[model samples]
Target: MVNVFEQEDIMNTLKHMHKWFNDGLINPDAATTDQGPKWCVVSSGQGFPGAEVSWATGRGKDVYAEPFAGPLYSTTSILGSVNAISASSKYKTEALKYLEFVNTDETMRNMFAYGIEGTDFSKNEDGTITRTENCYSPATYSQATYFTLYPVAPNAADQWDKVEEWNETAESSVLLGFNFDRTNVETEIANCSLIMSRYDKELYTGTRDPEEAVPALYEELEKAGLETIREEYQKQIDEWLASK
Candidate 1:
């Protein structure tokens, strides 16, 4: 990923952002806005195709979500949600058993995901679930394998099947399992992060001109040891690939 931040494609994207911001196509206060859920006519976020339903419900407005690109499986995405038992916990065995039950037992998994059956949610004759007004809603994927839970209303009963298919067919990134060991370059990483914190928000929010800001940012990053961090990442990736 050496020089990736200053690549031509990245610069072009920033330039497009600058044009949009200048033309009043983007929120002017985006760089400093603290208000949450400031509704806009359009927005982008990481989500599945059917996620628009939930988003629209939350914002009280009709919304449409279309994927800009195909899904690519990567280490970062896989690690987004995980449950880990504490090494120092005395209930490690019990925790493991609970996790196993949640993943393998359909009833337990569905209970955690959708709340009590016949109360918070009821299984429909068509195999979908009708959720009632309740405070027991949980992020389904984070709880257990999605296949174990019934689909909520408006989602197809075969939703999990489609999700499984998507996962099976998704292209895997070259860096799928390449976790960088930052031990050697911890200082460099810290310094580079500090430099990035200074300019990234303004540059990405289009508050600054990429033509001028990109070079200035890169200069500061280099001075802060970005090159050292890049070299270390490359070194680790090379070793990882060779091992594979």
Candidate 2:
């Protein structure tokens, strides 16, 4: 696959991005909104509905589904944002019991998922959930287990069964189990991060012309030892692949 920032590719990509902006196909002012490409890069339980509803609400005139261009890859490693109970908790036994309760108890799970159902939401005759008027979900992630959370949208309820199928069928990453220890490259990593932070927003959001920014970004990353970081990461990846 051609890197998006490569000299040949960057100019063309930026040209299209600029045209999209000029033609109102892209909204830079609302770049952080749920409808933004950045937020909807991949379908998510939360973002997908918001993006769909944007179309229903007359906000997604230019929005259309596009097929992903490249091969799909899922890391062998599991990904999550929630924290488990700490080992040192004073209520360790209680925490363990709570974990067991949430995992096994349907009523508790429903309560956590729906949030006092009559107030926050109500079940339709078809068994799908509809949010009550003037009510919002209380911390979507904190509700039930993520997987057990009831779908709020009609379409979502229909597609819920495919979530596991999609996850299981994704192509596994080549660098699956390896987590890079960047201690030796800490300085390089920090400098590269800083460089990306300075230029990434403008470049990624198409707020600035790539003709001027790309070379400068590359120059800064080079000075910041991006090559060294790449070499180190490649070494780890190669070793990981060999092991597998």
Candidate 3:
């Protein structure tokens, strides 16, 4: 609910990542070595309804991209939505339909729930589109807009069914059920997020000089939850993975 990334540096960094995405730099198959700030690019559609609509409505573009830095942490209310549905015994039938509604609704698209219609677009004489927004995405700390977006499959553009398919992949990917008991390190986790907010973009976007930037992040991250958080997360993840 509270936007922790309301800082100026972060916004600019997101815009910078946009430049690379439009250039076609991000690829999923790229080796891990190629996945960072180098030539790497992060790409996603929209997380917020307002933004998702905006991103998809351009005239003729097949795909558009947005950059990221943070994984865009989710509020418990948001992530726990599926859990509540499951508990209520409606997750299988009702919740899935709702997700479908989110993906294929024209009313939702016109509303720009996806993102603001980028600046370069206009209706054409043939009723097609004439858009020129050239935006790119960065591979670091980008968010799908707001965490509340839950558009279903068909809500995507007529030409972009693959995007919806990809969503299924994301939804079905590993790490579905597991809980984080951060009581021992809640402060550290919050603090690390707070501290990382300061340098996430500047360092990754090349504006802050990575060498100087990373060290500062480390010092603060330690106070926030560096070792403890990682240890705890890893410990939990290991147990969860083993159970699976």
Q: Count clashing residue pairs per candidate.
A: 0, 0, 42
Q: Estimate each model's TM-score.
A: 0.88, 0.70, 0.41
Q: Who wins the lDDT comparison?
A: 1
> Model 3, range 134-218, lDDT digits (tens) per residue?
6232321222222233332324333234444434344332445667788888888788878877776554444444445555677
Candidate 3 residue spans exceeding 4 A from truth: 1-172
Count of backbone collisions in candidate 1: 0
In order, the Cα lDDT scores of the candidates are 0.82, 0.64, 0.48
- After superposing all C-alphas onto the true structure, candidate 2 shows an RMSD in angstroms of 5.2
Lowest lDDT block of 10, candidate 1: 134-143
Find the 10 residues in a row with the least total lDDT in model 3: 137-146
**Could you report the Cα RMSD, in angstroms, for every candidate shown?**
2.3, 5.2, 13.6
How well does model 2 score by local distance difference test?
Answer: 0.64
Per-residue alpha-carbon lDDT of model 2 for 98-120, expressed as tens digits?
88888678667767766778888
RMSD of 1: 2.3
